[model samples]
Structures are given as C-alpha cells and as structure tokens.
Target: MGLRVQVDNLMEHHSQKSLFAVVLGEMQDGGLPHIGCRCPRCVSGRVGYAACLAIVDVRGAETAVYLLDATPDIKYQLNPLAEWLGPHPQRPNRFNPPTAVFLTHAHMGHIGGLPQLGPEAMAVDGLPVYASAELVALLQETRLWSPMVQGLALRLFSPNQPIPLAPDLTLTPIPVPHRDELGTGTFAFLINGPGKSLLYLPDIDSWQAWDAAHSVLQTVDVALVDGSFYSLAELNGRPPVAHPLISDTLAFFAGWPGELVFTHFNHTNPALEPNSGAVATIQQVGAKLAHPGMRFLLD
Candidate 1:
C-alpha cells in the first residue's frame, strides 16, 4: 500500500496509538447536523464535531497532550484521550487538561470551547494558551471574557516565530489570509515533531490569497486543510465566503508531494455521507477526508 493508505490503516488501530497527531473533528464552525439545517447530510444523521486536532507526544516517559483548537464539542473531543491525560491529581472525576491550546483565529469554532476551561467546567488552572499577540490581548484585556481566562496562562506568539514545546518539537505560527473581523489576526500552525512536520490549517480564505502557500505546504509532511464547502451550491446562492472551496483546493495542490487531508466540512457537504462520490473524488485525487479518531504519526 501507499504511504497514505499506510497512515490510514495505522489510524484505525486505536489501542496502538503512539506519539502522533489525531484528527479530532472534521466539521466547520457550525459543525454537521448544523443548527437548524435539515440538509440531507444533516437529516441523514451523519455529523461531526468542529475542526480540531490533538497532538500526543509520548517521546519521553511522560505523555504530553496538546489541542490545536478548542471547539464547541470539546467535552467529547477530550474525553476519549482520558488515558493519555491521566486522572487529575486534585479532581476525583476529571482528567488532566491538555498541555496547551493553540488558536487559529478568533472564529467561534476556534475559541468557543475556552469557557469550558473556566470555573464551571474543567476548571483548568494555569493551562497555557498560545495565540497571536493581538489575540492574547483581546482574550486577556476583554472584560467580557475575563472570568473564563482567569485560570488560563495566556502566551503571545509572533507570526512566523517558532515556539518550542519539547526539545525537538516546535510550533511555528504562519499568518494566513482569512476574514479577520475582530482585528485579532489569523494563524495556521506548522507543528514540527522530532522526525516529521505537519500543517494543521483548518481555516484560510483562499490559497491564492497567500503567496507563501506553496512553499509552506511543500515543506510539511501532511496538511489537514480546510474543506468547509464542497462547491458553491452549498452556499445556497449567497455571496461567496472567504473560504477556499474543496474543489479549488484539490486542483491547486494536486501535485504537491505531501499527504493532503481534507477537513472542516460544512453540514451541507455531501462528502459527509458514506456513499457520496465526493469522498471517492477526493481519493481519486490522492487526498483523504479527515474523520474523528484518525491518527497520523508525526515521527
């Protein structure tokens, strides 16, 4: 089998999970079975949580778990990894929180689950959250979100600068063009593991908008990119949004050597259905559709 197939096969075995990155959720901000939408994909009962990735580093004796984004379905997203997180030292029923959370932008799906870390829910204390400098201020200085951030250890990171996690694991924030309504800026993370690199870019306006798209993507071993909408039809005749359609992305990066995986699907996306040709179409182009629990070893 090819490398892509090998990765897919390895991901299917849950018990053997090792140092890797797991695709936690594959839906867009609204997620599948969307808020009041009765689309076929929604009505069919096939749904997924918002786009999220979990990085598990077990290179050392102690395992470190880091989440890429805090989606609305964070409770479900983090539950399955309880073993890795281990039982909280102080809390009887709770598992330890992730090592860190890296936000992509100020979108609802990206930062929506942050409140869960506050007093009412997980009550995480001193948990590190890395984001753009502006985003750090917005979350820290804003009075409205003050309560939720009380226990968070906010860290500001500059775009294109590498934030070292472990000795060899580093996260380089790459500024990508996206609809920045709050002036907080947007970032796509380039996670460099000990032996491999991966890009967890769930949102971007357009590939053409970013001049550095090719070079950055080329360097990564795998890229889980945005697949918000399959076509303009999903828009329901509304004006085009900033996201790059899945069709456009496939053609744009068809020849790129890295393993490309489509994620962040809208509820209207036909690819969510098991028998849909859209899934086959992606495979035909040497790409794969991301599903929850899918794991990819960075090393």
Candidate 2:
C-alpha cells in the first residue's frame, strides 16, 4: 500500500476517552531508498520512514500526543496526528508539537528530527523531552545542538522508574544493550495504560545479551522489537550486525503468551517483501510485521 493510504488509515480511528499506540514508521534509521543505494527495494520506489511510534491519550478535555522517537521523517510521521494535535495556536495551517517526546537513545534516526523543533522550523517553546541524564547532557553540551536544546525542557529519566502520564497511564524506561558510541544508555519504553501494556523496543543488540529480555517480554501485552536484518546475508559477508536476526527472534518468542511484532526493518531485509520466505516464517510462527498505521489499543 502507499504511504498516504497508510497514514489516512491511522487517522481514521481516533476514539475519545481512550489511549492507544500507533506505528509512525517501521524502517531502520537510514530508511528505505537508502542514500546512494540502488538495491531492489530502494529502486522500486518503495518508501518507509525511520522507526518511530506515537502514543495518543484522549481521555481528557483535549487529546495529548506523545512520540517515542523524533526520527528524520518526523514531519511526515506527525501528519497523521493532526486531528489529535489540533491546529497550532498561532500558525495558520500547522499542527502543534507533540505533548512530549521520549528518546530511546542518541541514534541519528532517534534524535535527528530535534533540529526541526529548533528556531529554524517548528520553534516549539519549552517542549518536554525526556531522556537519560547522559543523553540529555550530551545534547546540551554539544555546541551544534545548543539552539535546539535551549528550546526544550529536557528531563532526565532513570531506568525502571515509571513516569505517569495520566491516571493509569505510565511509561517506564528499561535499559537494553546496544551499540553505544557516546556512552549514553539505550532504553526500551514500556507503556502501561489502563487495560493493557505495550513495549516499544525498536533497537537492541540481541536478546541473549539482555538478561531481562524474557522477563520483560512476558510482562507486556505486545512488544514492538528490533528486526533490522533478516540474516547475516544482508550484511554482504561483513561482520554480524548489531540487531538480532528475525529468525532468532521468532525462535526466542516461539511459545510466549504476549504478541510478538517486528519493526525497524533494514532496506536489505527480505521480510520487507510480502511474499518472501522470511515473512512466511514469521507468520508461521504467529508473529507479526509492523507496518505504518498499525495500532494497539492501550485502554
């Protein structure tokens, strides 16, 4: 399906007095049609934005929208939330910024859109951006990002501590192993709503590396996890990639009770092709591939 169609579908179902999670983008940081690459998926005009998620809470007088990550494709990703976000107070045709944004780590795709919130673009004032203390300090200390950081009220969140968004809605950050070049910790957010809980974990090094993987997965009703590469073949004989293979992920969650869903697909991932064997294997194991517009009701 086309991107517009997917986005329209996402905007179609917005129930009041409810909370839900929506898939804003399902591709890796580079996104589809990766820069300067002539791969089949890239050349075929197939498009996908970097991995991102949005949480919408409509249990009050006004709807509140929170984003899990501010990807490079954030502008397009936020378009579907226009109705919930409402119109900007001063801007004629623009929508207001999200209620807040939580960062998983300091990766390019995770924090790149921050510049868009600076004086150059949205110019949002005092936006609450939550992240690890180290990550927030990194952004504040970097001279190049000072302009954008200055406008944001960056808050530090500790691992495993829950931040309540509403009466029964809380978000807890759980540390995970990943490629950390800047000494900033990576986190997977577990969002607990009234009726259900969902874990947003788009990037991780591997399941085995994290001792709490099984325990954490068992706690949530659904998990949106890293599926960056299907196999080492996608690496073209290079060393193993940071993310765990889809096959291994399926095996790890074979008989789990909770829903297992995959996202953050790399351009070379064969699972991106609807008819690929990789996709078939995922389905056969009762797992799911996340697509734009996919929704999980939290309450």
Candidate 3:
C-alpha cells in the first residue's frame, strides 16, 4: 500500500531500529489546501503538510531524533514521533523536544515553526538549531525572533562542511539555486548515515542551473528532489514558475542509478493524486511520490 502505512508497519515490527529518515510532509511551502483556493486537490482533503523530514536513530539506549526543516505543521508532524521523544523530564504530560533541528533555508515553510519552540508552545531550552551563517544571524539578531532564539542554541555552519551528528552520522549542506529572499542562501542536505546516504532536496529552481546536480545526485542511495509542478499548465496565465517540471527532471536524470522520490509538490499538481496519469508516468520510471509518514532506513 502507501509508503506511510509501510513505515508504520515497519516501526511496529521492529523491536530495535537503526538510523532512518521519515517524510514528515511532502507538499510545498504553502502546503496543500491553500488559504483561499478551492482547487480539486485542496477540496479533496488529500493535501499534505509542507516539506519536512525527521531523522531517527534508535540504536542507542535512548532514541535520538532530529528534524530537517521546521515546517508550519511542526506540531502534528512531531506527534507521530512522540514515542521516540519520550516525555519531558521537567514537565508533566508533555513530550521532550527533538534533539536538534537543521534548517535548509530561511523560507517560511522551512523555518516558520521556530515560534512553536518559544514560550507559547514547547518552550524548549538550549535546543540546537543548525543553519547557514546568514540565517543564524537573521534569526538571532531580529527582534521578532529574539524570544525563540533565546531558547535555541544556534550553530552556524558553512556549506560543504560536514556536521557530524554522531560517530557515523553526518550531514553536509550543499548550496543550491532557489528563490532566495532576504539575502539568505538555500541548501539541500546530504545525509550520510552509517551504511546509506540520502539527499533531501525539497526546493530548487532548475536542475540545469546547478553545476554539481549529476555528480551529487548520482552518488546518493536515495535522492528526494523537488517536483513542485508537473507541467507549465498548472501555472495558468502566471509567469513561468521557478521549479523544474517533473518531465524535465526525469529526462535530466535519465539512467542515473540512484532511487528517486519526488517531494514538495504544489497544490495543483496532478501527481499528488494516487490514481492520476502523472503518478503512473513517474511510477513507470521507477520513481515515486513522497507521502507523509514514509520512512527510509539508512542501513
């Protein structure tokens, strides 16, 4: 059945698990069911949360959990991992915050959930947040984000430098071209687990624009790249969108051996529907659409 269900089944069957990454969301920044749009997909209630991922390692006595991109739907996204997080040691009837959070960029969908970690919600103390130097400065120096920053330990990392999460687990941020506002750059995380590696690239302009697209993607065991729009028709009369179409992406990566799973879909994307022809085309090529709750074991 769906990858999400498969993940849940796998989690239940495993008494002890290894390093893995879970698909917390698969939709674009705004997520599905756009604010005022009455599109078929939005009305169908088949929409999903914005792009987010959770990396979990249960090999240790206490499960270690980290999140990639703090999306707007952080609350619901974090709920499924409550068992792994355990309970807050100081607070009763509350879950402990994730070990850390790594942001891909300063985009709203990527960092909007930081407020939830402030006084109003989790009120986490000393929670580690890894981001680019510019992003770290923007958040720490901005008055609006001061409250949240006070509770977080911001770590500024340069692109291409690997941040070791564990002895064997490392994450390297690779600069990628995207719609960058506020002068903060964008990144696609390359997660190197003990045995396997996956690239979590939710947003990008065009694959051709990237110099190392082929070299980086081909080296990973799994590549979850952007599939924001399936075709130009989805834009209607609007100017051409920034993201690469699914057709173009498929053709661009033709014959690449790594497994491809498309994520960060727009609301109007027909591939969001399981029975759509777009899905058939993608599946025919051995690639699949990302679904919430989907998990990929590193080993």
Which candidate leads the pack in TM-score?
Answer: 2
Report lDDT (CA) for all predictions: 0.85, 0.91, 0.88
**RMSD per model, one decimal:** 3.8, 1.1, 1.8
Instruction: Give all TM-scores, in the order shown.
Output: 0.93, 0.97, 0.96
lDDT score, residue 142, model 3? 92
lDDT at residue 140 of model 3 (Cα atoms): 81
lDDT of residue 235 for candidate 2: 92
Looking at model 2, residue 19 earns an lDDT score of: 83
lDDT (10s digit) by residue, model 3, range 1-299: 44346456757855476889989889898987887889887787665789998899998878889999999988878876777888988888899999999999998899999998888888889999999999999998898887677989999888999989889999999999998878889999999998899999998999999998878876699999999999999999899887999999999878988889999999989998889999999999999888876778886
**Collision count for each candidate, in order:** 0, 0, 0
TM-score, prediction 2? 0.97
Top candidate, metric lDDT: 2
lDDT of 1 by residue, 196-291 (tens): 899989989999999999889878999999998888988889999889988999989977988999899888877776678888898888999988
Candidate number with the higher lDDT (1 or 2): 2
Number of the candidate with higher TM-score, 1 or 2: 2
Model 1 compared with the native: what TM-score? 0.93
Q: How many angstroms is residue 290 displaced in model 2 relative to the true structure, after the best TM-score fit?
A: 0.6
